[model samples]
Target: MKTASIAHRVVDFLRRWPPFQYFDDDELFSLVSAGRVVFHERDELVFMQGRQRKPYVYVIQQGAVRLEEQSEDGVDQLRDVRGEGDLLGIGRYLGFGEHVYTARTETDVILYALPAEAFWETVKRHARASRFLATYFSVAILPPALEMREERSEELRLGRRPVDWMSRPVEQPSRPLTCLPDTAARDVARLLAERDAAAAVVIDGQGAPRGVVTPRTLSDEVASGRQPPDTPAQALMRPVCAVAAPGLEAGDYLTRMLDQQTEHLVLTANGRLDGPFAGVITRRDLTRVEGAAPLALIEDMARAPRISELAALRVQAEGVLAAGLTDPDATRWLAPMAGAFNAAVLRRVVMLVEGALADQGLASPNLDHCWVFFGSAARNELFTRHDLDCGLIYDDPDPGHARGARAYFLELGRRVSAALAACGFVTSAKAISAGHPSACRSVGEWEVAFADWIHQPIESCVYRATSRFDLRPVHGDCRLVERLERHIHGEEDRNPRFVPLLLEDSMANLPPLTFFRGLVVDDEGGYREVLDLLRATLQPVVDIARALALDSGRQAPTTLDRLLVLQPEDDESSLLIEETAAAFRNALYHRARTGLTTGTDGSRVDPAKLTRLEQNLLKSGFRTVLRLMEYTGRRYGLTPRR
Candidate 1:
């Protein structure tokens, strides 16, 4: 009788929430039948700063709750508030250890809770409703309300109208600067110093740029202390590297400067540099505004309330990154910037889960643990759609708070994954999310799992190993992941024999090329080029690097970094791998830039629009992918499967 009454109250509470709002009387009744209700008095703590907790998410019914965060300096500050219709206690259900923040009731509070097992089973049967509910939570449950309404507006706009964030902004110093060829060196230097600038365009009688006198020239000339200060600037001026443009995106302009490592860029109103310097872009300019919209959003996301917001911003940033790939320098700078965004999102996810767990009274105040991202997500080497591969680890073998800690992480994964999906990641068909029981194992359990994968060495294991090797830990008590590194290196160091096997696996997936000399897309015929590019080329680099790193017991953080660290510099094989990776990245940008410009899918490209030179660039890219595969294949004495 008591259980029935509790369930009734729970259903009544759920009826007020959006994702669950449409539930009919019977459906609501069915859902709360498996729920538990709890009561809290004023100033009562439902969860503490650290305690392991059971599996159940909570809903606020009659009173309000406050979520607060414990900072690095040991200060606690209120981060969020929850009241009627709000989903509460999700942290407890997610099961990440050590709450990111603590929670307290502002007044007498009545909450309805549903066990994790019950929630999962029910959500599985109600996939559509669950998705809706997940989306609802992602939108509604951010911490401190995270000032994310602006970014959210972007998402809404994106839903109804495609908005280009990478497009050049309206406000810029587009006015041309001019100087005379006969101007004295001291006079030109005067203009340069007055503007706090580096260069000026020396104009002729026709108002055309005749020669350029830049800070480089002035600095060198003045430092020599030989030429007269009043010497004509024409004697020191040199031809400038100018771009003929029909206007360019800021991304385009930035790419040019970074590629040449030059400070100044000259723009022409027409399509050639000789006409005149319409405007200039200095490294200072890029440095000042480098917090581009996506990066700004990423910075915003570091303090963002929920993973959903982070995910959305991350996807948008990925788009921005893709657009910048139109030039090589942009591609290189964008990679680490992408990593920054990825790391920020990941760090915030951990913080949020930590807060939630603490608020729920599930975290163990003293137990040590760390969280980490795995696979591409870990490396921040993610795509627009990818799985939320993450894990947790523990230091103490028999930490008494094991069960509650594990439970917290499981819940964290559940909520975060749901949020991640709402943000933009494609749903994993295999259900390999950290929320899954098998994937959300403790660090020791992870060791066992990794060991099994390594020792088995079968088809399934090979596939899993490739994914595992790419794993990077982004957040949490990072020692957990460090332990993972030690474990991998320790095992490899002992055996040294698996290196060949891994290299062989690297070559297993051959480069994609049709027998008829056209691109070989997949059986589905969707973005076959992307698949070929990644599998045939990119994966091989990732694989060969992992194998070589393992063989030498070296910890190379990135694929590029791994290539850079190889023993014999300038070796053909190493050079081939590095060059191929670069080419593949360039090809990816080619596709990305074209897509951004034409509103096409970013994954595929129509080769026809490319100029002959562009087409050649792409072919060079594909060949590089092939070459990368071949180099890895040769390294291990294996032939590609294809």
Candidate 2:
């Protein structure tokens, strides 16, 4: 009778906490039945650091526990403290195999020890419980030690309700309309029509998706006389992309769709091309997920009939940015989505300008071209409005037609640049813009210019040309952008001096830390004593990644992606790389959050306004920046110029 009473008390306490609150009565009772209550006196050690992980995780039934880690010099450092219903060991041993810190009682304490395996099993079976835990423990899964304070500003919470829903795993994927690779196009079309689906997946003999056929494919193939209705499904199909069904979240799926520029994504057992086909996520399915407002806004921007409408939509994007930063899971995917919003606006602006030009009897020059964005825009790292840094690249024209082609492109560039400026992305005189004659060029000219910059390796050329290396095509012939990429790589391969010089250049901007290793702020101008977030912290990481990427032949456009691509295998080196990536992400988030609050470019920040925790994070990040810069210098056998 006493044992039963103790179990009942433990179950009542567990029920009050989340994850447990999500469990039903039977599951809750079962979980509590297998758990035991333990007590410790003040200062008693609960678990020792570096010991094998225990099979159980503890819930604080009473009192408190503090987690401590011994530094290399044998000093104990407090990592965290847990009290009341707080859970312990979730982050430290998610898969770590050993306790990362020592847990000691802060007072006489009572803990309900739950079996880890049984708890995880319950979490997996209950989606809400799983998601709650996923968000609560995301720090382990993502870059660590970035504990930013949650924003409580009214502006940030405006659209917070919808994001809660968006973060859920995509509603169970719809049963995909499927066809064999050898199935006839007519049969595929019939399947799509009969199901009222817009697309059909072509599967292999093992049920893996090989291709997809959409209404567009049918129209372009059979209806346009390019092929008969009896043509094989494979012949009418396009290469398909699949995401694993397990652990798939709606917001993540939407981001994948935006990134891949696909209207549909096939679901598979393992999220690989060869994995067994499961189902599909289409545009309509995304619309059903309320968290897809950002995507819907982008689509609306694309079809917006006028620049005024696009400008209005641009204003709404700020709300999206604010809401994303306020949410934990959405924050991880914020950069890509912001970039999508920016690109969508730019594409819309270009289309509007082109249409206006046509009305004025100014048809674009008959040449293949691409409008490319530089720096953050190219890297898809944009969070808010930035000064437009762009250039135009087109196919080489006939000798006599060169001047005409350049003139036409320049006119288009000027108008588009002006349109973007009106739409909130102003063009700074110091930054590169497509309207500038030097940046508006044909393919051959662009090739020659890039080669000169590479072979020259002069400070002036490198300084002016750094942005060019980060270029990504936002519109037009992507092949032109690829040709430029190949040209740049080929030049680097031939000119070994180029990457080294670039590395040295990257090191020129020392981390903005004082002699005492504190954040350095501007001493003069309207923004005196304010830290330039971009220059002091963000740019060093960007520069290091760019130089390292070029040297390693990594062509990924973003700093984070570049870092991942070039990450070393050595444990020590890997930790430094990981820290550097985390620093960059933290700084970027801080800058964006600051920008949203201050209504500036997010470049300058007043450290005094930051929470103590945020200030500490910045200091830690700056230190990591210093370490990364030193690592880069050592790698290149060069020193930062005094």
Candidate 3:
């Protein structure tokens, strides 16, 4: 009877917080039954950083605990303060082998010691509980109230539709079709037919994957008479693309395939090329996953023949974006997939334009070139249609045909831009476009232009030239783009004053926040009480990322990608950087969601329309932006003006 009373008290405490709040009564009671109450005095250490794994985790019944870690200077730096109902030693529950930070009581505290083994066992049956823990642990630091509200929002959104299968763990094939490297091509084909498999994995004697064989191989090689029917499978095999099966979701599989530009992924015991093969995931397999809206759109855009048809398909991309915004878990992968759809449309646009030019009897000045995107499109973060910023770069011509080559490309660039405009990607007002003769230039000319911007450091010229640094080649020869990047970096190395001037230029637009940390709203625009999300918040973050990328010589194109490469000078700076990344994501999501719902460009958002939780989050995000500005000022030795 006494034991039952203790269990009841424990259950009451555990059910008040996540991830335990996500669990049902039976699961909660089971977890609480294995826990016992413990006490700690003020200033007593609960756990030490880098210590071996503990058998149990703690939940605070009352009082607070301070989490800190030793710095390089051998001083303890506080990271977080966990209050009542907060979970401690979460690393053990998450499979972390050692403590990452030392936890010490700030006041006399009562903790419920929950056995890690029992907790794990209880959570395994509760999928929602497990997911909550996963997401909660992934972030740096968030207030408990905000975290709980966000999870509740996620629950409501996720319940409105079927879960995205792409985010689920990919299943290992029970019987993957395999063949020896020495097997005949015809025999490999026959085996695939017998098993009704899409492709066959070529394996060596030790059961390690070597490569893959598809029907396309037969149609291109054996049937085309390039190779005989008796040719060895190894001779016709493409390099094997393999990934580990354990802990990898289907979205992860898709990302790897996109990175390697391959169609097939072989699942193995480990994520090594030489590891034992487990199964295969093909493009065809991905097509079958429900909620593959983005993948389907990309495929449709590739097959679209006319500018009008491509425009219609682009509208479907908005639908995909709308569905993704509602589900927070899926939004993380949405940007890249949406970018892929846009890239396909652009590639088709180029093809159609070239064909049209050929029909007009315009002939033969085929110089190697690359078509690149600038601004948000280049960063792979475009969720809504915005003004297009693009440029064209071609190889230099010989002295004799320079004039003709220039004329041919100029005409081609204008047609490409016109086609894109027809397809709803209207050119930017700044006129930094492929259609303009200034933006269409030879590789040598582009180098000279970039060099001028670096050495001269004029504010207006640098402002006009900033988009070029975010260059991402979507079509044509990539070598030209490579040459340009190398030249830009080399020029920065030579001109020491260039980067600081660039930093100053980036800091030109201050974060829109008042002295009391309130948002600065538009007073002159048609949308009263509305905040311009892009100008007020997102652009400042983008500017900082671009300047840092140029200064560090890191070629990564996206804001998040740039942050990944940056190493903060101190622990405080590191925490701020992490928080800044999170804030940027939240702000971007709000903008995208607003645009899709209101049919506007998504640059402006009315704060009064936001939920109470969103308003709070936005305020928190503004504080983060403010802190970031101070950090930047200190790092660059420049005062940031409000």
Candidate 4:
């Protein structure tokens, strides 16, 4: 074929794939014009494993190539198959320097050979193209952590910091609302209402902030008839837990608010209790400057009066997650915000359900009872498609009221589950919800159940125990959950067999990857070719992190946080942990983006549609997950199932 005809054909083929699809006509023509075509017969060796790579990368114009690994027995194992539009010999182009797998022609092949340096230079000139290339290369050959660090360093050098978008001074209004300790509670409430303020700060004689009085305090005291209208403000005030010095970055103060779970913070000159109070920075002020602030959404969730209101806020919260997907650091804030919203909604449902029960003359359960969330909800890593996985842990009632209490709580659970469903949460399919009889157990019953699961280690029980192990108190008495956590830790320590069983259970689902180190897609039923990002990518990391954290006696709920707190035994272990953490973050970013764009939970990823960067990150993440699984098996002395 003539030179122009061959170049035109190559350009046509390259345009069908991305980031080439993003290239304009002139760019496409130029890219292909600099490339040359080569033909290989069936069974021909394109590249040999362990040999230095050629200076050019190949793009298949026609036919197929097989990537193979030489086994210890000298037999070749099929790793991956590449066809039209697939880029071959990418390992060396990605700086691997040598081929890990030998590539041979599966059929007579027509390939376009592009100069590696020229192709890289072209990719670097386009931002999207560079990102796609970088992503692909990182997954195929580089460690995700190294890629992330390099990308972040480049961003910093270019003066594009994620914090820059959130950093601003907290706006302070002149003559902020203030009250004296001796002020009547009714008067303080009236003043707050008149000023349209969520809270008011109480100052001492020296103008140092003593406490903050919020609507919650007024509702708990005056409106509930626990205190009279003449009660002093000091009696209704809560000590301010978060205080910051003036002139500090607003982002710093916002971090404090999120950490403390407070809506208001007092600003003092020296950030000391005795220092003169400067002003107050309400959650509202911080949110005004940085919309989608997690602390602000949490405050909004808490104050929502109706289920409908919470449902609306849930959509907004998802929008925040969508925005956060572009920046990996934002994932840290996303989970906590989603958790707070889930907790608020659950609390509201419980309250409504209790009121309905009272109207029907059913007595309330003991105040010592707690509502415990399990699985993703407990980890505070909720996605929009997540189901309700929770149960009730109550103090045993008096002998005469025992039967009645059980009946009452079961009814309450059913009502609460229905209420949550009405607000968009689905009931747990595994019957893990509070409405299930087995889940609505007394504290002693729960202890017995845990002991049974620990001692038995049966398959069915192990599956149930996986969710139960990640317990968190979403509402009611938190002490119950605290006690349960201690019991779980103590049981694990005492039972030598528990850790191995847990490790075995965690290794049940390995990350889906084919022999050629390519992603395995769902070929089952309706979801053909779809990647189960949640199960194949996220779950393995979550399970491994959970087992390690539990074994180390670390109590962090979320997977990423647990991984962060774990003290790896050596430098190699530490590197593995770090790489796995980075991979986890990247997976979260991909899932969030997919969920946002598709209006679903972001659990399913279509590998074909993923950008080069996303694919690379995912591949690197899967690799890390596999390594972690192998480490677990070796550490526990468990043999592979083959």
- Identify the leading candidate in terms of TM-score: 4
Per-residue error for 321 in candidate 1, Å, reads 2.6
Model 3 Cα lDDT, one tens digit per residue, 1-642 = 699998987888777776687688887787778667899999999999999867887888888787787888988855556666666786765556899899999899999988887776666556555545544343455323222333336522412443366677766666889989999999998998898887888989888899889988977999999999999999998877446564577777776565344566887788788888888887777776654455556666777878999999988877766765664345567666656666777788888988888999999487899988877778877776666667789999998999998898888888888888788775447646787887899999899888888888684387777777788888889999999999999999999877777777666655443111123422111123567777666777888888888888877878988977898888887888887787788777777777667666677876656643355455456656666776887888876553
Q: Rate the local accuracy (lDDT) of all candidates.
A: 0.58, 0.76, 0.73, 0.73
Model 2 residue 177 lDDT score: 84
**Positional deviation of residue 414's Cα in model 3 after best superposition, in angstroms:** 1.4
What's each prediction's TM-score?
A: 0.50, 0.69, 0.70, 0.81
* Residue 618, candidate 4: alpha-carbon lDDT: 68
Model 4 segments more than 4 A misplaced:
19-34, 71-79, 93-95, 139-210, 214-233, 239-262, 266-280, 292-330, 514-528, 569-575, 589-602, 605-613, 639-642
After superposition, the stretches of candidate 2 with alpha carbons farther than 4 Å from their true spots are 1-174, 180-198, 202-251, 260-263, 267-278, 283-290, 327-331, 514-528
Candidate 2 TM-score, C-alpha based: 0.69
Model 1 residue 193 distance off true place after TM-score fit, in angstroms: 26
Count the clashes in each prediction.
Answer: 32, 1, 0, 4
What is the C-alpha lDDT profile of model 4 across 123-191, one tens digit per residue?
655655655555544332442323232334221121122444454676675767889999999899899
Total clashes, candidate 2?
1
Comparing 1 with 4 on lDDT, the higher-scoring candidate is 4
Mark the regions of model 1 whose C-alpha exceeds 4 Å error after superposition: 1-295, 306-312, 315-319, 360-366, 383-385, 397-400, 430-432, 514-531, 569-571, 590-615
